[model samples]
Target: MDLPVTVGIDGSESSLAAADWAAREALLRDRPLRVLHALPLMPHLLPARAAGGRPGGDLLHEVEHVLAMRHPDLRMRTEEAHDAAGAALLAAGEDADLLVLGARGSDGFPELRVGSTALLLAARTGCPTVVLPVEPPGPHPRDLVVVGVDARRPAEAALDFAFAAAHRYGLPLRAVHAGSVPRADLGGEAALLAGALEPWKAARPEVEVVADAESGGPGRVLVEASAKARLLVVGRRPAGPAALLGPVVHAVLHHAACPVAVVPGA
Candidate 1:
């Protein structure tokens, strides 16, 4: 069977927002939506009740009902996992097309930063993981999808995902490369960035691509662009335990205004 778009739920407002976003994505991809609730294993104590009522089962049902009401045609299912949030989500999303989670949970601070479980899952998940943030509704241009492109260790998976997403949303794709040298010194790097995107551009000629080479840190550049982007796509380096996520991806996850897609890259 085809892998579904899986979302981790914890009854938080941000988590529920993630569920809603996942439903829309599932409809767009013509895939099933799997809502997974991970209950931490208790050796001696019973499970703590979620915001609604009971622990796992009731919360799942409530989310199911909400999703059904919003997306009547979506194919949805719920599952309860007896494990840590990060472990359960990683295991359930092993074969998933995409794994989605809220940037923050109920225990999250008002600063609206990413939680530990979300960070770990994004770094370790086999499939692409999207982190959704809770923001007030406002008017903003949504015609572009921003992607952080690294010429040194470019990730084909991330580029492909960005191109496909831009094509799907009928938006332009902006490939931004950040460097420390002056803009003049970045001419060669800019050319290299364009060359890297040549195949993806040809593949989706319908999507306009703007190649930008700027002087500064990559994290700041991508985060700034994300303010007007429909989605920000970044590549996570496959590294050892200490270096799972590069500085660029880590910074963007914490500061990006829009939804962030972290794609594992070579």
Candidate 2:
């Protein structure tokens, strides 16, 4: 069976936005869209509510109706889980093509860039995760996908994702490397950036490629590049026992103006 593009929602405006974005993504990939809502688990002694009265059932129904109306021909489904948010989403996304989420939930603080559940799952989920910004992006659409390239890390997974997305949308792929080298050494930086992207460029010759090397903090540089990009792609090494996300990935997930795709890598 083909894997669906799944999105986790919690009745927040941000989550609703993510659902909308996930619908478009599903349409682009020619896959089904799964809307999931994670509800707090109740004690075993309590009686189970009817399907209609289940917590979050109304929200799920509303989301389904809205997305179905907007995407008339899209195949869609909704799921509600009685479990902690992070665990529920992680499990739901295991068999999915991609997992999309809101930066924060309804209960999150307004000042937070991302919620704990989103942060946890983004670092730990086996599949790639797309986390939308706090507010849905505006109507200014650009035809570019930006991926951050790190010389020290193996970024094959991220490069592959970026290239494929660009090809799918007929957009240009910008491979950005944020090195701390002095401005005078930009020539060397550009050469290294080109070399890093060469394999993927050759793999997808139909997609246009732009190599950019900037002198600054990686996070800041990538976030700046996201301003004109439709999507920003970054690699996250599988989480260790501590489940730590690298600083650069964490920064972009929170601050990038465009939707951020966190692809799992070595």
Candidate 3:
């Protein structure tokens, strides 16, 4: 059994956090860490200003050095490619045990891109992925973990990943139902979410489950939950209203104190 974590590093504060988070994950899984600093193929391959003026290769070296100083026992590798960050990481992920990325890049929205390499991988990659958040709170605070669940149904794979993580990390798992309810049906939201998590409850009888129906934004709710947690898990739907990594995800990516696992799928 070889557990491996592939973390994307680009020398940014967020990317550095990602490296640190991934190293801890790797250590926990009893796996070696691979600090992947992908070098874009060439100038045209990436926009002139994509990497903020510094060469991609330079960032890669910096990331490698950063990891070496922190985790001498950890192993790492770097690859250069012309593919998009998500595509490049996805390609390397073919044999990895897990993949990780920053919640969001420097990009802003509606033109801002929330479906970063992490989101793309979680949404499409065939393996488990964790999106390490770069803002508020802090690292693995108390080990409480939360996973966002859609009211319509619980994304099984996403929940499974979350549960496994919780179990492995010895953290309590909380299932969060994030959505808007009709003004008249406010009281029924908790019941609806409880009903939704029925199977998860039955399967993981030992794992603690708590439900939160936030009156405010779901992202804020998740981020708040994250402050006391070690990690947050979210499922990305393919092509529906829920499919998009909207505001909640965007907020969580930037503000979550702990590492966030963005598992893509409805």
Task: RMSD for all candidates, in order, please.
Answer: 2.1, 2.8, 4.8
Per residue, candidate 2 scores C-alpha lDDT tens digits across 1-266 of 89999999888899999999999999999999999988776654222432344567778889999998999989999998888889999998789999999999888999999999989988999989999999666666677999999854548989989999998888998888887889999888888778888888788999999888889999999998998899999998877888889999999988899999999986
- For model 2 the local lDDT of residue 99 reads 97
Clashing residue pairs for model 3: 41-81, 108-112, 109-112, 122-264, 123-264, 236-265
Mind giving the per-residue lDDT tens digits that candidate 3 earns over 12-95? Answer: 666777778788778777788877656666665553434566557666777778777887877666655556677778886777
lDDT (Cα, 0-100) at 51 in candidate 1: 33
Q: Report the alpha-carbon TM-score of model 1 versus the true structure.
A: 0.93
lDDT string for model 1 (1-266, tens) is 77899999888889999999999999988899999988766733324565334557888998999999999999999998888888899898788999999988766677758888888888888889999866732368767999999876678999999998898888889999887877778898888888888888888889999999888999999988988888999988764576467788889888888999999866
Lowest lDDT 10-residue stretch of candidate 2: 44-53
Lowest summed lDDT window (length 10), candidate 3: 106-115
Model 3 reaches what TM-score against the true structure? 0.73
- Kindly report which residue pairs in candidate 1 clash with one another: none
Residue 42 C-alpha lDDT in model 1: 70
Q: Output the number of the lDDT-best candidate.
A: 2
For all candidates in order, the CA lDDT equals 0.86, 0.88, 0.70
